[model samples]
Target: MKGIPMRINVLQHTPNEGPGMIQDWSDKNGYEMFIYHPYQFGYLPTADETDMLVILGGPMSPNDDLPWIKQERELIQELLNQDKPIFGVCYGAQQIVKTMGYQVTKSPAKEVGFAPVYRRDVKFLNIPEELNVLHWHEEMFEVPEQAQLLFSSDKVENQGFILNHRVVGLQFHLEPKEDNVREIVVNDFPYIKGSVLNQTSEEILQTKISDDNKQTLYKLLDYIIEK
Candidate 1:
């Protein structure tokens, strides 16, 4: 008999910020994906029913005291308690850090558009020393205790981290394709400012989406799930 497929529960905040390349990854891996819009439906899956939980990016800050946000944090905490695998992006990353008793504050600068993240003493995970990836967040998470710092950019000290070798949080977006980048730029251009680290809307749209970024994202997902 064929084995049952793993279920990936996605917590989506807004319509514009979908799973991007993660959906493709799930399909390729034969994992069943169930996207939940807690803002609209006010419902979330329990840790028992979810094989993997994906927390996608959004414009809202994880510091918001909204009911749905609180509930989502609770769900994330339960997942952590059960040692379930989780992958978090942008605001989702902040949520994970916040759930782990850390502060989510405004970043030094709004890291918009494509930027290079340097590897920061990360072992066991095979990633390039430097990689250009999409970043469109104004708030960032403080690295939690006992978490391995993965990558860091010039503007953001905590670009990524891994906890218990199963939960991953990324401040930069490695799962965005060209179209996905376009949608983010269009929706989040207002946050982009004129700074050394920030990019203009035109520049953000003009930058090429590298396949290496997607491959890196896939590698991370595989690593977390197989752990």
Candidate 2:
């Protein structure tokens, strides 16, 4: 690991919602990791300092009237312009789409808990066609122009998308850990209203451990880094 470059930065939007499995992957792989919390810390890092940028999931919507939302969007645009490797999850995905000139809106059906994502016909850098992934978001993002659609759910068509292979946005929680899912269910359950909130904690536990999904996520990460 001496010659290996280790420069990975994870932009965390919320304290409770930091990188879950991604952190583990990075640590085990000897990649140096840094967390930039724009919400509480009020400091944003320059895109040039980071090799890869991972925007983690959060409870707030991208359309929310928060100053940090705009700041984050601007940083996303800058990163996109630099053609840096970027990965986004849930709200982070929405922000990526919004930064690329697409709109993020509330989905017709609130997608909470585990959901199945059908692989699209389009081939990613080397991603699989179908996989079940963890989902816990009320909002979904519109596919931006020139972005390749990756995965889709029955409720939400735009579950995952790729922008020129390097930039990927996923609506599902590919990096969700057991405790992360449980914490979201316990603390963020009240915010999830309607039928989406009907699922019990037991049901959530069952869905988070889909081995197939975790394998697919590893494939994705490998592809992203290699590409």
Candidate 3:
């Protein structure tokens, strides 16, 4: 391990979506965190200076023809070049998949509320057999050949993956606080269009997130940082 007080840089695509447990964990662990909103501003920190990279969820797809999207991928490539640990959530995970030359497309069955992701195999990650996590995306990606599949959901087979053992990507949100959920529900109301795999906004509100997801998130953070 490098040491205490790691420099973690977060790439936020929107003001509505902020790093929830990520920021909380970083603060508790005393890791210096810096957030960059490419949508609100235009600048990327050098990869070398950052010990880890965190990509937060957003409304836009990774394949969108936006300048910031391209720039985000470029920075991700540079971070990969530096062999830095990276944690991506939802759209952030899609960005990592796309940067790895994989394709992300509209899901046949999208998840708009809480869903269960079952563990495929006991490899590096110490995840549960099945864990319910927050879901709010209609797009999913193919697992890259170089990545190890970690979890699989009914709607999306590729629920979680790890690249180079240090980089982790999750299609679901383990880091969501209750307020985060409320904010997303309010902002992404359009996505909750009541698909077969999706739940109604009221249904989502009635559901309570399990504690195991947040606990596992802490374990995963430790795993990446320790590696």
The candidate scoring highest on TM-score is 1
Q: Where is model 3 more than 4 Å wrong at Cα?
A: 1-4
Candidate 2 displacement at residue 72 in angstroms: 1.2
lDDT: which candidate is best?
1
Better of 2 and 3 by lDDT: 3
TM-score for all models, in order of appearance: 0.96, 0.91, 0.93
Backbone clashes counted, model 2: 1
**Can you write out model 2's per-residue Cα lDDT over 89-184, one digit (the tens) per residue?**
998899999887789988978877776788886664455666666777878899988988888998889998877757888998888778887777
lDDT of 1 by residue, 107-192 (tens): 88777778899988875678788899888777889999889899999888899998887899999888888888778778767778
lDDT of 3 by residue, 26-133 (tens): 989988999998877888777777899999888899988999888889889988887888999989999999998999999878788887889887555666789988
Per-residue lDDT of 70 in model 3: 87
Candidate 1, overall lDDT? 0.88
lDDT scores of the candidates, listed in order: 0.88, 0.80, 0.85
Compute the lDDT for candidate 2. Answer: 0.80
Q: Rank the models by TM-score, top first.
A: 1, 3, 2
Shift in Å, residue 223, candidate 2: 1.8
Clashes of 3: 0
